[model samples]
Target: MKEVRFFYAPEATITEELPQDEATHAIRVLRLQSGDEIFFMDGKGAFHRAEITLVTNKKCMYRIVETMQQEPTWRGHIHLAIAPTKMMDRVEWMVEKATEIGFDEISFLNCRFSERTKIRTDRIEKIVVSAVKQSHKAWKPIVNEMLDFKNFICQPREGRKFICHCYEEVSKEDFFSLISSVSQEESLHESDDITVLVGPEGDFSIDEVRMALDNGYESVTLGKSRLRTETAGLQAVSMSNLARRI
Candidate 1:
């Protein structure tokens, strides 16, 4: 049977009835019939394999056939602090792709050079859900509230940390190089736990870069090409995971 996945905001489980909107989507949109199989998640890494027992315009009830519980992820931890772009669409795209690529935590830094001042929460969250479903991933990324640029840069980062920046400084290493040099420990991939910072479209100021260094973040470059804020962030995420594949 084809599986339909839905995100329930309230609460959910193998026993709990799905919310109205989900029921509508399953019954009205997907034309899910009784006894059909589907999947639902609480977006907290709890995945339920459900079979439709009752389907109605107002509500739907499913019997939990299987329950796969996942711990809240810190696995392959990738946290990105990015500067919002002048065009909000870029940032929205960044969120969608980043979610698809998989990141544990995401934060926005309101950098001095940031062209875009405010973010549309509705738009970004919408992208996140679609990407989460598209990638068939059990976990979702937390899009944090915007941080003060200077304050953000000054914060200490636990575990392995790198700040992707442009301009000549110490010779920058390819993300793959950094990912490769770390030796794997136990079951976990080495360097799987990481945090990266990508600045805004306008880019981070000199002071911001300095603040990051003060906070223990190593200044690294992604390459010679000057990438947009969103591109840099997404690329870092992609590389973070792809390193495991290589």
Candidate 2:
């Protein structure tokens, strides 16, 4: 049996053809010919099994053989909001890994101590799409434009909210432990949303932390060792993923 290749094509259907970029890859890079089997994810929790029907240098047409709806492997919606690192590579790395690990949404925060306040979401979204295809994820993660620290923190959200900061004066709890407790309390559904805020290289300003706290975002710690902005973001996602296993 041949391993079925997965491609992202939200608009693909039983009659529709693969998109130009996907078609090009299928016909050129993969050297796929007519009758070769492949699958496409709509990035909305659905997958379509397809077979190539026509191949050209710039286009590859396909006929859908079947449609499959996949349930998410992880529970709840995991959202990570972080200040982009000074170096774009670090933030991009985090985005890729987090997508593979599974997350629902990502927000870029513009914080007081943030070294980089701007981000090109177009490039980042492409990275995210690539990650989803590479990871075989059925649902696409929502990537948002960068927002001011105070503005982002004040936005209304549901489920357990947390902010990771290094201020010792402010009481904090273990990230994983809080996740566990939040899940156990109130007999919450396994799919309850979790939103975590991670700061930049300089970390969130003390006043910013205070504002987040005032806005009902609990203070939490990844661990004793201080983490870089990108690392902290990934750690938050990792801890949340683990918390669901309990």
| Predicted model with the maximum lDDT | 2
Candidate 1 TM-score over all chains jointly: 0.84
Among residues 3 or more apart in sequence or in different chains, the pairs in candidate 2 whose N, CA or C atoms overlap within 3 Å are: 76-191
TM-score per model over all chains = 0.84, 0.92
lDDT of 2 by residue, 217-243 (tens): 999999988678899999999888877
TM-score of 2: 0.92
lDDT of candidate 1 over 1-246, digit per residue (tens): 135555553366634687776677777888888898878666778777778898776778888888788664334677888878887878888888888777778888788888866777667777887787667667777777788877776676656778887756644667667765665564363345778888876667877787777787777887767787788888888877666443
lDDT of 2: 0.87
- CA lDDT for candidate 1: 0.74
lDDT of each: 0.74, 0.87
What RMSD does model 1 have?
3.3
Superposed model 2: Cα runs more than 4 Å off: 183-185, 189-191
